[model samples]
Target: MAVVSLEGLSKRYGNHLAVDDVSFDVGDREVMGLLGPNGSGKTTILRTLTGYLRPTAGIVRVAGFDVVQEGRLARRRIGYVPEDAPLYPQMRVNEFLAFMGRLRGLDGQKLDVSLGLARKRLGLEDVGETIIGRLSRGYRQRVCLAQAVLHEPDLLVLDEPTNGLDPRQIIEFRTLIRSLAEHCAIVVSSHILAEIARLADRVAILLDGRLLAVRQVKASGSIRLRARTDLAPGIVSALRTAMAGVEIAEAPQAGGMVSLHVSTAEDGAVDQVIARLAAAGIGIVEMSEAGADLEETFLAVTSRKAFH
Candidate 1:
């Protein structure tokens, strides 16, 4: 069963349709990435899911509880970390978590256990008694995540979770996200294509308050081919013949090696292209699935005009 479900969900303000008929589900152990430009209704959709705003139309359920009708119950099953997580600068890490736990109706040993587990999972052991204002930006983000998961919610929602973190912090944040996904469903919203590609199992693209496409990100489809010889007419012809809709372009040469950027619209094109090259004896020095980068894919999806 889906831990989080939204069917025909729409939210409007006056004449503007901020979210139009947005619908999707997040199951156990799934990380759903929400992608869109500014004013695309990603934050509005997330707020609706968390029961902070009543949708203008459509149904939303979290852990089988209706967000509109049973908001209190529904909210208990969700963990939300907004772009700017409000933190009390005066409070210590453990003190703040304890306060949040009590608000969630946790007390006594249960609250202690929850706080302990959250600290360990989020690598906050050293900062338990540290003041919130004194922690670094990365540690602050970790605290936000720790508080979100403290209640053991069934679904976790994060908006631009890595916005200001450094490179190393971003990597550590990604690790924490992956670790959190082991027990609950996660919905992350980000404009950074690389972050979504690295952290999410599936990506849902939103454009003008409408869902454009949901893509299954895999490692084997992005093919980068390098040539031992110059990208000659013969090599280009062989590639075009072997793979339809393959995009090939010249790349910077390294160590006197000719390089070509090859992109395929379909999977398994790499194998066929490699075989055809060998038959015609076109030197293929290196060919591998390119590392995870979804910038091109995001542009391809979002560039299309949305239907009225």
Candidate 2:
């Protein structure tokens, strides 16, 4: 079962519809990225998923519990870090995390274990006595993340978690997120395309309060072959016949070189393609796995006509 599910979820404020029929799911141990610009309802959808805002229409379920009908149960399975980290400036890191643990109904040995694990995982041991207000932006974000995972919820929700971090900090944050995904599903909402591409297994693009598309950021069993010479039409046809269920399409290229993207469901497709191209006397220049084209897709869907 999906860790988080949204079906025809919509949210409105007065006459303004903030989210329109947005639906998607985050599977167990999966990283689902929500990609869009500011004011595109990414935050609104997240708020609804966390049960902070009731959807104006449709349903949201987290771990088989309805977010509205069973808000407490559903929320217990979710650990959310909003765009802004909610921290008490005066409180120390350890104190704040302990307070959050108590609020989540943890106590005694259970709370102690949870706190110890969270602190160790987020590298907060050295900063345990440091005031939250005195910590750097990156460390503060880590604290927020630590608290969210205190109870080890089934689903983790993060909204613009790296907004103010430096490059090194962002890289470190990405590593931490990936490590967490080994145990639970994660939903990260961000307008930055590169971050989403690097962090998510799949991304759902939102625009103008509607879902534009959901695309896989990691293309499994896909490779790109660049040749100095173009393959003959016959060779292309022969390759298609040789590899059933393989899709070969030309990718945009420059300097008169040919770049073909080959995607297949079967293993060893790369070896097969290489062998055929060599047999056809095509001079292979480069062969690499195809990465995400999320930027292209995002631009295509969000494009608007130029004004005179």
Candidate 3:
């Protein structure tokens, strides 16, 4: 069910190496978030995937077609929405979509059906006759998506699809992306961390032209263990000895609490560690899971080199 695959894909400028031996497989019906800071080579990777730029090395496959060798087939099967979606300013929405559909080799009832679906799914039904220049930025983005998907491409490549959208528009965009999950594989690249955590089925963080980490949308194992001891010595050593992989995360004497983040190999180790410390004469004030969210994970991994 792998719809898109990139192995050792690399691109470089004259003196600077951009994407270095980057590789990953995108499965069917997946919404993958591509994350990175500015100038992190994210745009380069997307451009290469869309065939706007040929890679200096490695292979890229979209819907079982090689991006370079079978360039036409690959391009035909992919719906690419760049950060700045190209739209003819004077063209009417429906007219532009029809033109785009024709370019994709879609015609007759089949093409009509595709347009219908795009309009309904992307909430562009009422704006069909509006000129592109008069539409709001959010609606314009939707129009861009409508054009990209007017022919129902099998693989959707969206680079910062929700970049300039308002909060309401951002939510609507997320809903549209989730609904499209049944038909095509999607790759959405954005620097907004929270949005990725909420919308992505998986996440890949890129930095300085390299992929730092790739992860599923599973909840990270996180805990905030507060050290509370009535005695003067504190429970610092007790924490270190009893809990493996536990580090001092926060310690506030005014609050009479010392918070530590515990990372253990096995599951449910937090409760056990807390029980052990309590049994050994240490006091427990409060225990809760901190924000080990995707943003935190993205920051942690991307700050370092690639973790494979």
Candidate 4:
């Protein structure tokens, strides 16, 4: 069974349907990215998942417990960090983490161990004594994460986890989240496709309060090709007609080598693509397997339908 599951989830604000029949699941050890533009139901989904807002229809479950009916159990298994990661400005970093840990029912030796682990895991030891208001944005974000994971929840949910982070800090935070996957399932909500590509094992695209598609993070059965000569317009057209639904794009290349990225929705189409290219008189000088990038897929999915 999935550790986190949303079945036919929907929410409404008076006349507005904020989320519409959204459904997806995140298994143990999986990192699922929830992607959508602003007001596209991504925030609504997260809020519903965390039990902050009740669903107008359908159900949300965490660790097999229904979020609404078993709110305490479900919430206990989830650690959440919102987009802004609000923190107490006057409290010291260690103090705040300790306060959060105790609030979650940890105490004595166990609380100490949890605090120690959070400090080391998030690299907060150096800034433990620093006040929250004085810490850099990156360190403050880390503190927020530390508090979220202090109780060692079975699932972690982060909304725009790297929103205000510098490039280096973003990289570090991504690495930290990936490491956390070894211990629990994670759901990251973001509008940044590239960051989602880096952190998520799978991606769920949402648009206008509806789910568009769910895609695996790693591409399978895709191929990259290099040819000595540029593909003629006629050959390109012929290849497109011969292998319908196969996506082929000319990639930028240096040293005059023409590169083509090819992927097909149908099974066993790699050979068919190669044959079509050869039949079209385009010589395949090199061939290698490649992953389908999320950026292109994201654009294609979101652009499919116009949204207000």
TM-score (all chains, Cα) for each model: 0.78, 0.76, 0.76, 0.76
Candidate number achieving the greatest TM-score relative to the actual structure: 1
lDDT of 4 at 11: 99
TM-score of 2: 0.76
Write model 3 residue lDDT over 1-308, tens digit each, in one string: 58989999889898899888888888998888888887778889888988999999999999888889999989988898898889999999999999999988889998899889999989999999999999999899899888887767788989888887887687667777878877888988888776776667898788888888888865444666665535324555665677677555554566565556655543344444556666678766667655657767776886676854
Q: Pick the candidate with the highest lDDT.
A: 2
lDDT of 2 by residue, 1-308 (tens): 99999999989999999998888888999999999889989999999999999999999999999999999999999999998999998999999999999999999999999999998888889999999999999999999999999999999999999999997798778878988998899999999987887788999988878888888875346877776435535446767877878777876567767777778875445556766666766566788766547777778766852111
Worst 10 residues of 2 by lDDT: 299-308
Candidate lDDT (C-alpha), each? 0.84, 0.86, 0.80, 0.85
RMSD of each: 9.0, 9.4, 10.8, 10.4
- Cα misplacement distance, residue 229 of candidate 4 (Å): 24
lDDT of 1 by residue, 31-126 (tens): 999988888889999999998899999999999999999999999999899999878888999999999889889999999999999999999999
Misplaced by over 4 Å in model 4 are: 219-292, 303-308
lDDT of 2 at 141: 96
Instruction: Supply the global lDDT for candidate 3.
Output: 0.80
Q: Candidate 4's residue-wise lDDT over 1-308, tens digit each?
A: 89999999999999999999988999999999998888889988999999999999999999999999999999999999999898999999989999999999999999999999999999999988899999889888889989998988889999889987887688678778888888889999999876787678899999889898898866455778786545535445766798767677887578676777777665344546666776777666787767557877788887786322
